[model samples]
Target: MAANPWFSWTYVVENADTLWEHTVQHAVLTVEAVAIATVIAVPLGILVSRIRWLAGIVIGTAAVLYTVPSLALFAILAPLLGIGRTPVLIGLVAYALLVILRNTVAGLDAVDPAVLDAARGLGYGPGRVLVHVSLPNALPSVVAGLRLATVSTVAMVTVGVVVGYGGLGQLMFQGFRNNFYRAEIMAATLACVLLAVVLDVAIWAGGRALTPWRERRRA
Candidate 1:
């Protein structure tokens, strides 16, 4: 393949199936982590926002977890979880919590007080006002958080290779271990970047769908 050329079409042709497998694994892991984080973070965010006192405690803990070194967190979980996707998923979710939680809380808090009061005046209960009014207004920020978390998760999926489940990371590390095979490494790296971009765009579209009124306002 032209003496290990950086762009070897032959290498890609020969390893297409393996490459596709790794890419699929990478995408799936990213999706799973982000989805789980969203489910946990969103509700926790709502609770903390309502409680006021718990906001710092919960978000601060998530922020601390975010600062824990990714490799170190993965290693710590490995002993307990026994070397697999479980530890990797847990670590990724830990990292995602801060961003998503912060965005959710901020979005909820940013909902106009006057609008909430008006909803109350119209006989809406607190729960109804929050669900029907506050959450919809906060949709953009929450989705922004999700987008950030998803892209970051895609990049972090590579870290899972240490625990034996990093999708494209497997290919990248394989190339590195095999004397820096340019084609394999480049292919994996490019795939990771492209996955992140596609996910960000997808989330942006989702956010738009959730707030079509915002689009109509712009129009």
Candidate 2:
């Protein structure tokens, strides 16, 4: 007889399809932003790494971008990029620059100078040294930066829903509007949290796997 009630949990199930669709859409938004952010940031990062004068200016600009409020950025972009994925993605990509750029710089800086000298001594050209020695060593930091950019993108995508692209934030807003306190809202929050956790853990694991020297040193 208790098969149905006001809070029987069916309310959550009812909205599952819409919620899933939004989650998938949000993931797509996140992945695309990360891809674009990585490409732009990494090249600039490498260039600035080689030129000390540009590093402060470029990275400082990225830090400034990170400080701007997401909502404000969205509002500014909305008129130009219009209300859709384009503006939202643009904002997320901007927000990602600090993490990506900083990490790239750090990785490049952390490369062993002695190793670089040895490579040069061995007749390795600049191109060969960068390709075989520098990049591989800098990879951990690059991945760290990519991971940070990805997580930031995921979180920011929900905020972009304010521009009408619609995501988990939309679901939560709808639940509040309807005054139903639907389980769907809880589920959406859980999904977002899960996504964050998965990214964090995966990055952590991958970072460790890539840097076995660190593990051996600790051992």
Candidate 3:
């Protein structure tokens, strides 16, 4: 009788070393893309939130960019960037902006008017108030956005297989090419899932640590 390929540990054991390398590559790609997106999107979000009229245009543009098909984007980008990690990184960054930007805008907008007024009343300059009060208060929302972007990026990185930059996704692709090698496919899928779960938990814990005041307020 044939054993269940999905549950087979053979591929995992056979390819353990390569699997680890691919996992690391996947993690690095995901982290770099998200970090870049956050840096660019957070500031743009703040600017749009501040200049109300610009919000529509900036966000709308991001939305349109986000709506572009991932493969199509890759096809377009591969020509300009020339394969490897650059196109994948650029695509992931583009995919992430909408979530991060909207979250940043929402977070900043959600900051209490009373809190801002109090900071100003205390002689805090606009810049100081934003840094000390507005940003801190809005951090929960921002972190929430980061969590979403992180998970989405993890899933999207698999699409990077289209451009020879799949990371763990490469395992699955190899399995597909090798006649339904379910063990490889399953292992790769499991690794990606586990990575996403771990990242989500870490982000959640970091958010809690950063927003200790929320716990105090509740208490």
Model 2 lDDT per residue over 1-219, tens place:
243323435655776688679888877787788889889998998899888999889998999999999999999999998998889988988999889889988999999999999999999998899888887789889998888788777778888878987577777677667664556567767777777677778877987898788778889
- Model 3 misplaced regions, further than 4 Å: 1-4
Per-residue alpha-carbon lDDT of candidate 3 for residues 1-219, written as tens digits (9 for 90 to 100): 155377567767878899899999999999999999999999998899889999989999999999999999999999999888999999999999999999999999988898899999999998998889988998999999999999999999999999899899999898889887788888999999999999989999999999999999999
What are the TM-scores, per candidate, against the unseen true structure? 0.97, 0.87, 0.97
Which of the two candidates, 2 or 3, achieves a greater TM-score against the reference?
3
- RMSD of each candidate relative to the true structure: 1.1, 3.2, 1.1
Regions more than 4 Å wrong, model 2: 1-9, 180-182, 204-219
> Considering summed lDDT, which 10 consecutive residues are worst modelled in model 1?
1-10
Q: Please list all clashing residue pairs in model 2, or write none if there are none.
A: none
Model 1, CA-based lDDT: 0.92
lDDT of 1 at 63: 90
Clashing pairs in 1: none
Q: Where does model 1 exceed 4 Å of error?
A: none
Model 2 score (lDDT): 0.82
